[model samples]
Target: MKTISKWLALVVTVFLVLAGCSGGGDSADSGKGENGKVQISFINGFTGGDGAYMKKITDAFNASQDKYEVVELQEKDHYTKFKSGEYDLVVIHGNNLETYKQDGLIQDMSSVLEKAGIAETDFHQAGIDTVKLDDTMYAVPLDIHPLTMFYNKEFVQEAPKTYEDLVKINDELQAQSKDLYALGVPSSGLVEFYMLMIAAQNGIDLEKDGYLNFAQPEYAEALMQFHDMVWKDKVSPAGLGLDGEFQTFMKEAQEGKAYQTAVALTGPWFYGGAKEKYGDNLGVAPIPQIGSQLAAYGNSHTIALPANVKDEEKLAGIAEYLKFMYTPENLINWADGGQAPVHLPTLEKVTAEQEKYQIAYQNSQQFDDYVSAPQVYQFGEQIRYMNESVFSKVVTTEKLTTDALMKELEKATEMAKQIAATAPQQ
Candidate 1:
């Protein structure tokens, strides 16, 4: 919520349009403008509220320096545009680095960050590993958005840290009124939530299991913990279709009207809107630990050097921008944008002054078990298989039985294998 008005908030609507819709590049140009100040064009999928945060970051850099100007664009197809050689720097998801590297769309970033005075070790190891392939780095890690629980403060007096707490909170709310329920399983990040349970409760290792490792009974049992919440436990309603949890969480409760969906397990992106709607009533916490660990499933944003940019001037600008952006003071505002700063130095700053960034910037304890995507080129595809092919079907169709889920997993596994075979060798 702090980032809602941290810097340059006014006139953001106009900035939003220009940042998200504009396109840039010159085929014969060396990315250096006539003034001799290099122009570094950046592209990313940080559209909507996200676009404002990133735009502010780049805008600040542009104002602070005269030697370079950073222009950022928010494109739905950012990676594709980067591949077209129109952008020098682009932000991609941690899960996508492998695909980007394999396709030769980005160059090794092992030296770019180091040369900019940012140490690779300062980032979360899991985040660092996401950009590394064959011991070579391809991107500089930005922020981590871990799956967390957002609850209505009025409905639940305290955050649920354990499975028992969840049950008690659920019963207490339902006791007041049947319509008031404390838990609402997510639809968009269903795969991450499911994997978080298995890792915490069952201790399933991702590296050992591989990317498409959802066919086992243990995995099925873990997934059912959520499906049962909707079907058997009755904590959540059936057919909470795509992003229904978030939609309901942000739904403004009328005067004297209690929220139907009071609790949500979603990523940090929910903070900007939820805080606006619920204010201090919006509480955030690590996703409750059903077992021994509070390991949360997380995703990250990484700034990568697009391979198409060969201009030395633009590369210099990109390097300076990386250094300026991650400077602890400059990067702190990013957390106000509802992300956990994975850069260790910036992490220290956020935790040292919790209330300063307390709203949605997750505290340090959450990252102890925070993880990036599995080291597989098909990681993104595996999530698609689970979310669209398997998990979503369970929610929409109410096929909660283990045998039924396993059958769907088998089909998904075949898909996983087919895609792996078709992909070029690493």
Candidate 2:
């Protein structure tokens, strides 16, 4: 009898110990909050005013749900951190989606969309198309920021309706020696984007058979037009980089100077800052017809799940969080942060609201027509090199002709192709 009793006691002790170990292991592996709510982190580069709005949305999601907790991390290099497993999801520029998808750093989100009950058609067609590579969805687009025209209402009663009008305004401004120009052209690599916009307007395809074709006549014409604006017409201040142009415009506007930039070609993100400085004097309009058709440069912000996150529960949590973030109500909050909503329903709501900057919102609606620059990996660096080595010379030095700029562009294209070839393949 004593032996049996002792065996039973040992068995009970061993079972209890095993159960406790299993419980601890589950808790450690799950990384759940109290009550088994799955914990996930979202990484993004919303360090400006948008960060506050993102935080509010995140907090609202946390409060509305008990099954998941989303923690937001604001970091500029979100992709690096996401690859390190620090975040379950990351918001990347729409341009980077292709690079990330090709490298297998981010996973196809079709399953996530299905699980979240989101159809591809739910978002703006342009935004949806931006994140799709051959029918495989990789990211959910959040917003589109298109380069639009910001004109000084005090200087110009109506926005320029045509390219000739823009040039005439600049010519008039220069005649007055008013220290004001019709436009502030940024020489800091933005000239490449401007050229792309103009090329798109002329129906010139920038990419052909996986190669860049900037040696085309349309590109040459675009280059000359930009050069003339800076050097010959002197509409743009000589040697004015992006920051220099922005600072000059903002300073003049803030000081109520008679001679301020008459029109600025910038993105919707600048609307908030410009409105703050110029108040009602700031006007927003679609980029005037620069080419045969109206086209401008634009890009989007997107949310994507990292490829390293293989845990189903964590992925489910992420999908839920994204769905919550894109709800019509939450998207309105996103718009309040100066982002143009990408969800179709939210866009409809925003259009109806009309309480915010109506001109900016209306201009944003035209993003579908905007042309986005090619998003090849390291392509931005190649463009920057072209700007500094080739385009800058044309604007600053009278000796460098448009033909010379075209030759440099050809070299840049070759270098870009080499870089893209070496970049990670899909």
| Candidate 1 lDDT over residue span 334-410, tens digit each | 87676777788888888888876874355345767775566666677765777765777666556568889888877
Q: What is the lDDT of candidate 1?
A: 0.73
Off by over 4 Å in 1: 1-29, 187-201, 206-211, 251-259, 396-399
Off by over 4 Å in 2: 1-30, 253-259, 357-360
Q: Let me know the TM-score candidate 2 reaches against the reference structure.
A: 0.86
> Candidate 1: deviation at residue 42, Å?
1.4
Cα lDDT for residue 145, model 2? 79
Error of 1 at 46 (Å): 1.6
lDDT of each: 0.73, 0.74
Tell me the tens digit of each residue's lDDT in model 2 across 192-212.
556677777888887754446
RMSD of each: 11.0, 8.5
